[model samples]
Target: MFTINNLLDIMVLVIFMNMQEKLTILADSAKYDASCSSSGSALKRHGDIGNTAYSGICHSFASDGRCISLLKILMTNCCIFDCKYCLNRKSNNIKRALFTPEEICEITINFYRRNYIEGLFLSSGIIKSPDYTMNLMIETISLLRHKYKFGGYIHAKAIPGASTYLLNKLGNLVDRLSANIELPTENGLKLLAPNKDTNKITKIMEYIKENKSQTFVPAGQSTQMIIGATKETDYEIMKRSSEMYHNYSLKRVFYSAYIPVNKDNLLPSLNLPPLKRENRLYQADWLMRFYHFKVNDLLNADNPNFNLLLDPKADWALRHLEEFPKEINTCSYNDLLKIPGIGVTSAKRIISSRKYFKISFNDLQKMGIVLKRAKYFIVCDGKYFVNNLCFNRSFIESNLVLEDNLLTSLKGEQLSLF
Candidate 1:
């Protein structure tokens, strides 16, 4: 039964099984990564095989939360670093796969034509060394751009230890570049992803901003920070966000709520990631960029985080209640923005409509501004229209929560729709 030919036959079967297993493992592992979308650079075909569109396509998501489009597979699943949260961590006892640059290009081209995906995502697990892996990633982009003339949307991951030259070159070809901050703080990185250098990662982000101006990467750069994995306060996160926006001119900083994939003793064992915290951070970020609220105004040493119950802006208003009860008819647009229920859109509507005639409480209701919270903060035509009995802003804010649901449901109704 143990003949030489029989042994060779078993070995051949084993190799085939291993290859099949590797593909399944790597693709399944990649499903959890949600860093999708193409919005940075625009590449023209110039009589080449393919072309890039400004609005890139994202197909769908599996249960694990990865956006499924563009053949979202890693170049290799064999990592050198032992990031505890990563599925492909060096200590992971799982099947691994590595694709040659040509193989990846062939797959992308075929997939694009069949309408399976618009392009390629092409991330890796730090095979061999960071510098070497970075080169391979660049080489893959080079092959796709130069040899294949692939003008489709290509989103490439900037390898951690990759040189500036490699990043700048890769930036030229790909539509978007993301250098994941992984963890929020240096201590978090030290505990969760020991090998990662926080300083080096930040430097790469700055370099991306510096170079992307004159050449490609018009969409600018975006990075991801894992939340709830470490003890980093939301204040700390926003502080870094402030610097990142000011110094590097980053387009977005995404937050991936940390779901413990591995059962490490050091990690939390929550059934779901801190989605609420993630939502609040996005809200705060919107305020910073659009609402003209500074990070310092939102948090301080004593209050180094956001309130889970109330939004950041509402909470800020509660602490400083004396500024409320302003005249709605005469209040300027900038002043209207500070009112609890009135947003930029509503404030502009008030300013435009009131110029024709003085605005009353009835008129504000017709303009579609939420009045429950605005009542405590605004006066209509020299009349105290609302109860105003409860001076506490929190009581008014609590009642305002129902408006979002009511408005959302009324969107398709005949009264609102047509």
Candidate 2:
């Protein structure tokens, strides 16, 4: 026989417990999404609470090189589908939590004022159905914008198999959106995450494309594929990524190292995450996106995987020795980009500065080119810089050197948020 006052007291306790308990559980649950980076949004919403710029979001890098300061968390950790590799899969015995739409709005506003976060990166487990989960997230973002006037950046992941209408609604509100192609191929999804497929995932992207002509997803869409999860080759993954850029107009493709979170017969027992492979893939992606390199330019049947010892660009240069020792004086801008160690800024500097004065080896170093790496690939005016170094064989060990002046490079300065 509980009194009305007793019932109220019990309800109050449950609510308090939910706030702290759920925040921890849901935040930890959302950590698996590496595509939550909030950048490249040129949106300016009038009278909004937060603002999104190229680097307006804080660029606080983690010790592991991950950026932070976004209030990234899941709406719920209770899923209907059981993906074996997932820590929060239905079969896994774990603490579950849910954040109401109002609570998400409250947290974002409070965190913004306290300077604890610059924006929100919201994701969720498939609770009840994809529609239910996506709508809940959409509701959360709507409250942040309309009710709280939160003008801050928002990057949300679209749930696979979610309704097209719900998907369209979501694109209108957030600064950026992503649909995680968790596994590299359809076969990998069928074996592990049996319920999900690329077909359903691509439908959302297709819808976005149809709607993109309007103001939908103004910051553009991006995606992530978990590397080392399946038997898919680097060539296959890169081919798919290139197709996405040309086919769906994707802004970026993120590669996540497969960190084993659960034990399964389907998964390999690894000592550590394949971070080196992951880094190489990102460098390859950069070549495609920024360096004007094509998929075929980086890979073929003979060289399916990128060399772990050297970067993708340097590796390509080493393989094609005949192309090296490029005379910088007469090379076109496009050809300059092909040289190893030369980036967009350095290539531009060569073109621009050469018009005024003849480019030299020392001048290149001042222009932010890594002389140690570039010297092996370029001939300055008529004289070769590293002419003595043999390129007939792999110079991987001797040629290996890091460019410390990345921040001073023309491209580097352009990327700085502040």
Candidate 3:
């Protein structure tokens, strides 16, 4: 009953099936890497295929909250290491795929022409050795740059313990380079991912900084740490992060919430990833980098965990009430930033405009300050705006969470003052 037409259809279907399977396995394997931010480059393009400038690349987040849309994939998932936390670890019976250098180049070009992706985030599971794997990566990126003339953004991962020669080679060819820190502390590494160590990771980071003049890495270097996989406290993890930034000059440290892929007795038994913890860390990180907050300012030995209900800044403001009720009109720029509702923009605006006139409560609202939380921490023209509202921490915390018709209530408070 079979005919030549039916035979053609079957062969075509088989090809699609095979490619689909490879894409599925490799893409799923890549989800564990949490180092995918691509916004740090400043390269301009003339007539190149794409640019990492103005419209460099726009990021789209996956369902689980990792950045996607850069053709994020691994060169191969057939890793030699048997790190129990990894799904692609050896000894696990799973289908594997490897994209030849030619195939990878063609896929990148095709995707770019179709506007499907603006760049590539190429990572790989170790095939032979770290140097061998790094060379394979170098070849793919080299082909994309030289042969295909790809001028778009690229985020390359530096294999830990790879030869410095190979690492420097790839660094010249990519916009961003990252080596995963894997775990925050040394004890965490020994317990969960025994094959990895922080010493090797830090050495690579140190090397990149030393060789930046010779290598490109224009976007600077970054690293990643898995949260909640071990017993390290948030304080400990952030303290290490702070050290890395000051010591190694890292641009960013990405925190990925741990998802238990395999049941190892050494791992925590969780039904879902700790996304909230990950988010709080990011908020705290932002405070550190931009808001001029020190790690000690955010967390200490006694208070290690972030409050789930309120953000770190709000929580800190609530605990350190003596620092609050700061006069908006005359407080120093540094003090203006400490209030929960006031951000960098609002703080700058207050500093700029207060020279002309005495700013009132309404002026703060117009400056994009979040008054719902700021009202508790700031005073306008020696007048407390939330004078009628409860000043206790519990009342403010509950009101902030419930929102509780608070904005309208505050408006009423304003009307009564007249």
Candidate 4:
């Protein structure tokens, strides 16, 4: 009773359903990677489909304070390695899917045309071999670039053991590239992810570092470390980050709070992910990157973990209170940044405004400084903002804690309709 047209319609429907299933599986599998944020690419071409000039193209934010929008998905969830931490490890019995180069292009083009996404964040689990997997990725992105002329941002993950030739080819085609470090220490890698070689990962980073030109990976590279998966402390993690930034010239180092995806004796049996620890690490990382703080300045063997009650900058200020009460009118720009409430922008405003006239406490407020914290640490026009302010550590700490709790309580309260 079925005609040729009806048969064709049924076949098309089946194909669409199959692709939808693949999209669901691959996208869900890709959620764990935190290094997918895009930025620093300015590639534009004449008569191209899209460009990366404005900011970045991903679902999350870039380090430059821009919201990046993209379709973040994995090329495939199939794997050849058996890492204990990975959900898609070959030993785990999970529904697997793979997308051909043509299918990937079709999805990307269709999605971009519909304004569903701005770009693509492509990653993969090892399929057959590292080189084989990387080659497939390169072909998919290459097809997007040449055939579709898609000039939008593309962030690709570099396979750990892929050859230099493939790496070079992939780097030239994508805006940003990342090779995840996975763990802070080589010992942790050996314990949790035996198949993943820390040496191979760093070698990939080194390759990118040495070969990066203006045209190749113009957005630069980033790496991610899984926190709380191993016993390594925050100090150890920061030290590794400092090393990567200095040695590899990385754009950013992302911190992922480990979620228990697989059950193994080697892994921690946590009821929930250590999200608070991750936030603290990010705060410490910001201080290191922007405020010119070293790992030793924040922590050492004596105090290896961040304080749960206070942020890294505030905690440091409390310990080093002798350096505080900085004069707003005369202090250096860097010194202004050391104040808890003064950010980079506010500090710049203070410097620029004070040149014209002496900055008062009201001017500090006008400059967008959080006087609640800065009041205890800074003075303006040779006068304390809070008269007879006690510089005692315990007194200042108790007040700061009370203010933080009040703010948190206010944030949690529901609005009343009068």
Pick the lDDT winner. 4
Worst 10 residues of 3 by lDDT: 1-10
Candidate 3's TM-score: 0.89
- Please list the residue runs of candidate 1 whose C-alpha ends up more than 4 Å from where it truly belongs after superposition: 1-24, 40-71, 114-118, 326-333, 341-344, 347-385, 388-391, 401-418
Candidate 1: minimum summed lDDT over ten consecutive residues — where?
A: 1-10
TM-score of 4: 0.91
Error of 2 at 5 (Å): 30
The C-alpha TM-scores of every prediction are 0.81, 0.89, 0.89, 0.91
Ranking by TM-score: 4, 2, 3, 1
Worst 10 residues of 4 by lDDT: 1-10
lDDT of each: 0.75, 0.78, 0.79, 0.84
Candidate with top TM-score is: 4
Q: What are the runs in model 2 whose C-alpha is more than 4 Å off? A: 1-18, 386-391, 394-397, 401-418
Residue-level lDDT tens digits of model 3 in 7-80 = 35434533554666777877789877776666667765332587675334555756544446588888877677
Instruction: Supply candidate 3's per-residue lDDT for 359.
Output: 86
Model 3, global lDDT = 0.79
RMSD, candidate 2, Å? 5.7
Q: Considering lDDT, where higher is better, how would the candidates rank from best to worst?
A: 4, 3, 2, 1
TM-score attained by model 2? 0.89
Q: Over the stretch 1-418, how does candidate 4's per-residue lDDT look in tens digits?
A: 2111223543453366588798988988987887545568876644257777555544545443334476788888878788999988878887777788898998988888776677899999887789988999999999999998898878899999999999999999998888999999999999988899899999999999998887898889999999999999999999999999999999999898899999999999999778768888988888989999999999999999999778789899999999978999999999999999778988888888888988888877777777878888887777876664577788889988888778768887322111
**Looking at model 2, how many pairs of residues clash?**
3
Flag regions of model 3 displaced more than 4 Å: 1-17, 45-47, 54-56, 404-418
Superior by TM-score: candidate 2 or candidate 3: 2
